[model samples]
Target: MIYDQPKFLPGGDRYMLVEFGNEMNLELNFMGQSLAQAVADNDVKGVIETAPCFASTLIHYEPEDISFKDLQSEMASLIGTLGPSEDIELDSRLFYFPTVYCDPWTKEAVDDYRAKIAEKEPDPEFVARLNGLSDVDQFVRVHSGTEYWVASLGFWPGLPFMMALDPRCMLTAPKYNPPRTWTPQGTVGMGGASTCIYPVATPGGYQMFGRTPVPIWDTQKRFPQFENSICLFQPGDRVKFVPCELDVYELVEAQVADGSYQYNVVEYQKFSVRNYKAWVESLDTSARF
Candidate 1:
C-alpha cells in the first residue's frame, strides 16, 4: 500500500492532481484524505488547497513560488501518516435547517433552461416519482457515532467534501437520475458512503434528500462570487443535519450572516472565463494565495 516513488503529477503549469487512480476503495479514499490533511496541516508553502476525489487529490498552488518537484517530494513524505487511528476525526455531527424544494420549476421554467446543459441532466423523473434512491438499503453501518473527516477542500472556498457515512447510506450511481442544477444552495446528498451538501449551489449531479441553511459560502469574498467561501468540512469531524423549523431557519441564516453559527457535520461545476475570474478573486487573500 505504498507508492514508494510517489506518483508525480503534471501540475498543469500551476495546479496538480496527484492521482491515486479512479478506485472508490475505502483504503484509497482514506489515504487520499489523510495525505491532503497532512499537506495542509504541515502548512506546505504555496499550497492553496487540496481536493480529493475518487482516486486523486488535486492540489492548487503557485508553481512559480514552489517547484513541482519540491511539492511532490513534500507529498511523498506526507504519505507516512493517515487512517482511523492516525488523527482526530473532525467530530462531524448533525445540524438541521429548512429547505423548500418543490421542483420549483414549472414547465415554463424547465423550457427556459432546457437549452442549457443544466436542464438536461436531472434526477430521473422516474427516480423522483418512485422516491427510488431512498429505498436503497442503508448501505453502511457504524460501530458508534464518530465525527466525519474533511477529505479535501476546493471547487468553492469553504466547500470541503467530507467523509463518514454508513455504507447503508452510501449511494451508488444512477438507481435514478439526479438534478442537473440543485438549488443555488440547499442540497444534502450522500455519495459512496460520504454525505455532503453544496453550501451554495451552482451546478452539480448528486442525489438530493433535504436542505439546510448552513451558509457554507460567503459571496462578499469577491464580486460576482459563486456562493463564495463555502464553509469547508474538515477531517476528524462529526456531522449531522438538524431538521429545522422555519423560525430556526431564519435564525440560522442570520447567525451565518453574522459569522456566528456552527454545524455538527455538514459540508461543482463547470466554469466559463467569467467563472474562472470569480474563483481567483474569491480566494483567501493571505498566504501564498
Candidate 2:
C-alpha cells in the first residue's frame, strides 16, 4: 500500500522523530518497523539507536559525529528505498502464554479497585459488555482465538502493547477512568484499541481480565528464552493466549518458582505483511469473533 510522505520532526538536539501517519494501524506500524530495520542494515554513521513505535520511529544520534540535517537526510534516503510496507517481511516468533481467565488474582484486584476506587460491576463482565460479547466466556474465546501482534514494548521493561492480527477478533474498550494503583505482574489487560501483558507489577489503566504464570520479563535472565535480554518480547513477535484452568496455572507457577519452566515458543514461521493483509481481506467479519 502507498503511504503519504513521512514527517520528520526535531525531537531535540540528539533525537529525531519520523512519523509515518497520525493514525494507529498496521500499515503505518509496519512502515515504521521496516524503516528501523533498514537503518540497522545500512549502519549509517553517527546513528546511535532507533525505537519504532506504533506509527513513528525515534532515532538517536550523536551531534558530534554527524549534524542533525545530515542524519535526517541519510534517514530519508534509507526510508526512500523501503518501498512498500506490505512487502516488508519480518522475522517473527510465535509464543503461547498459558493463562487463567477471570482468575482469583485478577478478580481480587478488580474487586479491590471497585471498592476503593470506583463502584462498578466485575471487570470481566464490564469488559465483556463493552466489547459487544454476551458474556465473559465468549469474550475470552474471542481474545484467545486470534493471534496478537506485539507492536512495541514500552510503559515498563518487557511490557508489550499488543494488537490483534485478525480484524474480526479486534475489540475496543475505554481505559479505567483513574487508572489502577497497582496491577499484578503478568496481568493481561486491554486499553483503548490494544491489548497488553504487564511484565511487572505497576500502575495501569487497561481493563484487567486474566493472569499468566509465564514470565514475560526475567531480571536475572535465568531461562534460555531470556538469554539475550531480560525482555522476552520484541516488535513483530506474535502471542497467543491459551486459556487454562486453575490447576494448570498452579502447576506452571510451581515450575516457574523452581526455575524449571520452559516457555512454549515456535521460531519456524516468518511473518509476511503482504500475505497477512490478503488473508485478512479474505475473511468475513463474522468469522473474526
Candidate 3:
C-alpha cells in the first residue's frame, strides 16, 4: 500500500532514504522513480546520485554542500511539483534473453541443497505446485509468456528485481530456508512475486528454475551494450525470457565466450504509465497464460 506521503529518513551522514511505502507495488515504484528523475532533471544541488528501489529511493548527497534538513525540504518540494504516477514517462529498453528452463544446472544445485541442507521438492516442481499450475511445463509457459518490468537493480551489480508486466503471468514462491552456498551466474529464479537473474555466481535463496547464457553483467566490457556501464540493464528496462533448449543455450554461450554475442534489444522507447494502466484494465485479471 502507498503511504499518505513519502517518509524521509536520513541514512547516516551521506545518504537519505525516501520511502513511498512498505509494500512492493508498481505504483509505489513509479512514485519513487518519478521523484528520482525529478531530482536528476532539476539538478538538485547536493544530490550525488539516486538509487530507486522497489518501494523507496536512496539518495546520496554531499553534506558539505547542503544539510540533511535542507535536502529533505528540497525533495519534499520537488515531490509536490510532480503530478501523479499516471503522468510519469520514462525511457525503457526491451531485451530478449534465451532462457533454458528446468535445465540441469539449477537441477544439480537443487539436488545438492536437498542432499546437504534438508529434503525439499525440486525448485521448478515446487514452484509449479505452489502456484497451482498443472506442472512445470505450464509454469514455464506462464513465466515466459509476458515481458517483465525491471523495477530496480540491487543485491548485486546488474541483478534486476523484476515483476510481471502481465497480471496472468505473476508467480510467487518462497526463498530457500538455508540459502544455497552458491548460485550459477545467469540463473533466473523468483522469491515472493519478484523474478531475478543472478549476475554472477553468489549465495542466493530464490527458487531457481532457469538459466540464461547471456551475460547481464560484464566487467571486461565484452559487448557494445556495456559501453556506458558494466551493467547491461537500468531501472525501467523490460525483459522477455525466450524459452529455449540446452542446444540453443550452449550456442549463445559459445558466442559470448568469443565476444561475438549480439544483444537482442529494442532501444529508446518511451514508456507511458497512463497507457500501461489502460492496457492492464482491458485484460482479464483472473485469466492465466
Candidate 4:
C-alpha cells in the first residue's frame, strides 16, 4: 500500500533509503523515478547517485559534504516538487527481443532441477495451469502480448526485474522450491507478477518459460548500445518479447557471435503516466490477448 507520506530511513552512514510505499506498483515507481530525476535536475548537493527500485529510491551521498538531517530536508523538498504520479513523464526506450517460448534449454534445466533437488511439474505447464490458462500456447500468447516495464535491476549484474505493462497480460507464478542450481543465460521467467531476463547463468528461483538469443549484458561492449553501461536496461526502459522459432533464434545467435546483430530500439519515446492510466482505465481487465 502507498504511504500517506514518504518515509526517509538511514542506510548505513552514506546511504539514505526513501520509501514511497510498501507495495509494488507502477504509481509508486513513478514517484521514485520522479524523485531520482528531481535530485539530478535540482543538483542536490553531496549526492553521489540515486538507485530507484519498485517502490523506493536508495540515495548514495557523501556524509562529509551533507549531514543526514540536511540531506533528508533536501530530499523532502525534491519530493514535493515531483507533484503527482499521473503528471509524470519520463524518457523510456522500447526494445524488441526475439524470444523462443517453451524452449529446450529452460526445459532441460527444470528437468535437471527436479531430478537433483525436488520433483515438480514442468515450468511452463505448471505456470499455465496455475494461471487458469488453457495450455502453454495460450500462456505464451498472453505473456508476449504486451510490453514489460523494467522496474529495477537486482540479484545479478544487469539482470532486470520487470512487470507487465498491460493489465490483461499480468500473470503470476511460484518460484522453484529449493531454487534451481543454474538458469540459462537470456532465459525469460516470471514470479509474483514480475518477469525477468537472466543476464547470465546463475542460481535462480523464477519459473522459466522462454529463452532469448540477444544478449542483454555484454562486458566486452560489443554492441553500440553498451557504450554507456554494460547493462542493457534502466528502470524506465520497456521490453517487448517477440516469439520466434529455433531457427530464427539460432540465426540471431550467429549474428551476435560475429558482432553483426543490431538491437531493435525506439529511443525517442517518452512514457506518459497520464496516458497510460487512461488506457488502463479503458481496458477490460478480464480480457486476454
Candidate 5:
C-alpha cells in the first residue's frame, strides 16, 4: 500500500533505517513489514537482511555490492509501487497460551523488589490500579479478554512485543525505572504499550504479572510444534491469553516435560487494517478501562 514519504536514515555504515513514521502504529508497522517482505521477494542484490519494527525497517546490506545512494534509490522506487498499508494483507496465526495470572512466582518476584523496584504496590496490583480496574481479578479478566497482536519480537529471542487487537483492551504501564536484575522465563509482563512473555530468565524492565507453562523458545527444537524454528511466535501472529488455575498449569508443565504438549495454533490469511481500524473506532471509550 502507498504510505507517506519515509525518512531514510543511515544506521552506521552497514545498515539503513527506513522510518514510516515517528510513532508506533499498526498501519506504520504494516508498511514496514510489507516493505521488508517485498525486499525479500524481489531478492534485491546486496541486501543482506531486513528487520521490521513498529514503524521502521532496518536494512543490512553489503556496501561493496551497492553504494548507499544506489540502495536508497532502489528502496525509494520499490516503496513507490507499494500500495497503501491498509490494503496490504498478511498471513497470520492465532495462538492460545494458558496463563496463571498473579501466580506465586511473579508475585514473589514483585514482592522481592517492592521496596526498590515497584512504584506503589506489587506489580500486578499496581498495573490494575493504573488501568483503573477494581482489583487483580478484573486485571486478569481484562488482560485475557482480547486477542493481542504480535507486533514484533525483540529484547530476547521469541519474546514477542504484542499490542492488544481490541482497542478496548489497551492498557499502558511504564517500565521499571532501575529495571529488574532478573525475570523468570515464561513470565508475562507489560511495559509501555505492549505486552511480552519472557523467553528466558534475564534482566528486564517490564512489570511482571503472570506465568505460562509452555515454552516459547526451545534450543533443542525437539517437540513437533518447534520443528520449524526455536521461536514459536512471529510478527503478525495473534495470541490470546487464557487464564488457568494452578492445577491446569501443572498439567501443562507435565505434558511439556514429556514433549507431548502441542501448541494451539490456528492459521489464517491476511489481516485487513481497514477492517481493524473500523472496529477500533467503533468501540466505546468506557470499554477500554
Candidate 6:
C-alpha cells in the first residue's frame, strides 16, 4: 500500500490518519516516514500542524480553510514526487540528570531485577543512554537511546515524547499502586523501557526512582509553547536527562514560588497532568476540576 493514495476517513471531516501498515514492523515505519515527508515537504494550503509517530502521521488542519478532499488529493500527488528519506540525525547533547534512587523511593527488588546496591546510593546517572526507535531520518543515533526522539507529546503540556527504549535496558513495571497527586516536581521515572519525567510534583504511577531539574513543562508563561505541546519533548527533537541533587530541588521550589519567576503555575499544572492523567481525568468524570 506504499504506492496507494492515502484513503479518506469516512467519518471525520476535520482530520484523517495516514496509516502505513497494520503491523508495527520496520518496513512499515519507513513507509510511514515517506508519507509524512511527502506531506511536510509539499506546499499545502491549510495545514496548521503535522505530527509523525513510529508508524503513522497525524495531520491537523482547519477544514474551513481547505477542504479535506483537496488536501487529500495534494498529499497523494506529492507522495509520488517525494524523495528518499535522509537519515534522522538528532541533536547531540550529553548532560547529567539528578536523581534520588533510595529505599522508600525505589523498591528493594522487582522480580528478576534482583540487585541490591543500597549501601550509600546508586549512581545518579542511572542511564548511560536510551534506544529503541531507529527511524534513521528522525533519530539515527538512538541506537543505544543515548540520543532520544520526541515521538508523541501528550498527557501534559511540555512533556515531549522520548522514543521507545531498547528491549534490554527496559526495567520491569513497578508494583501497582494508587498514583500520588503531587510527585515532587522533576521526578525521574521509568516504565516498560520508557524514560519519563513527572515534569512537576504531582501524583504518578510509574516507578519514580529519582528526580531531575530540567523542567518538563511550563504553562506558567502567558502563552503555551507549540500551542499545545503536552510534553516538553516533541515529535522530532532529542533530550538529555540531567540529574540533580535533592538539595537542588529545594532551591528550585523556592525559585518557583518566588513572584519574580515567569512560569511557576504553568510548569506545575502542565506536568501535574503529566504526573497522572488518570487522576485528573478522573476528577472530570466526578465533576471536579
TM-scores for all candidates?
Answer: 0.56, 0.89, 0.91, 0.89, 0.89, 0.51
- Number of the predicted model whose TM-score against the real structure is largest: 3
lDDT of each prediction vs. the true structure? 0.50, 0.88, 0.92, 0.92, 0.86, 0.46
Model 5's alpha-carbon lDDT is 0.86
What tens digits encode model 3's per-residue C-alpha lDDT throughout 82-115? Answer: 7878877888999999999999998999899899
Instruction: State the lDDT of candidate 2 residue by residue for 41-107, as single tens digits.
Output: 9898898999887888899989999998898789888888888777778799999999999989888
- Please write out the lDDT profile of model 1 over residues 23-70, one tens digit for every residue: 454446566766776887899998988777645778888887798889
Candidate 1, residue 200: lDDT: 67
- After superposition, candidate 5 runs with Cα above 4 Å error: 1-3, 114-120, 268-270
The regions of model 6 sitting more than 4 angstroms off are: 1-11, 21-43, 65-69, 86-90, 102-146, 164-167, 170-184, 190-193, 201-209, 219-236, 240-289
Candidate 2 lDDT score relative to the true structure: 0.88
Clash numbers, per candidate:
54, 0, 0, 0, 4, 39
Worst 10 residues of 4 by lDDT: 79-88
Better of 3 and 6 by lDDT: 3
Q: Sort all candidates by lDDT, best to worst.
A: 4, 3, 2, 5, 1, 6
TM-score of 6: 0.51
Least well predicted 10-residue stretch by lDDT in candidate 2: 1-10
TM-score of 2: 0.89
lDDT of 5 by residue, 64-172 (tens): 9988899999899888778876775677889899999999998877777775655446888889899899998888888898898898877788899888887777888
lDDT, model 2, position 197:
93
lDDT of 6 by residue, 47-135 (tens): 87765555566677778888878877766676556544333333322223334443233332221133322132121222222222223
Give per-residue CA lDDT, model 4, range 1-289, as digits (tens). Answer: 9998899999999999999998777998888878888999988889999988889999999999999999999988888777777777889999999999999999999989888899999989999999999999999999999999999888899999998999999999988788888999999999888899999999999999999999999899999999999999888899999999999999999999999999999999999999999999999999977
22, model 4: CA deviation in Å?
Answer: 3.1
Off by over 4 Å in 4: 9-15, 42-48, 61-73
Model 3 CA deviation exceeding 4 Å by range:
9-15, 42-48, 61-70
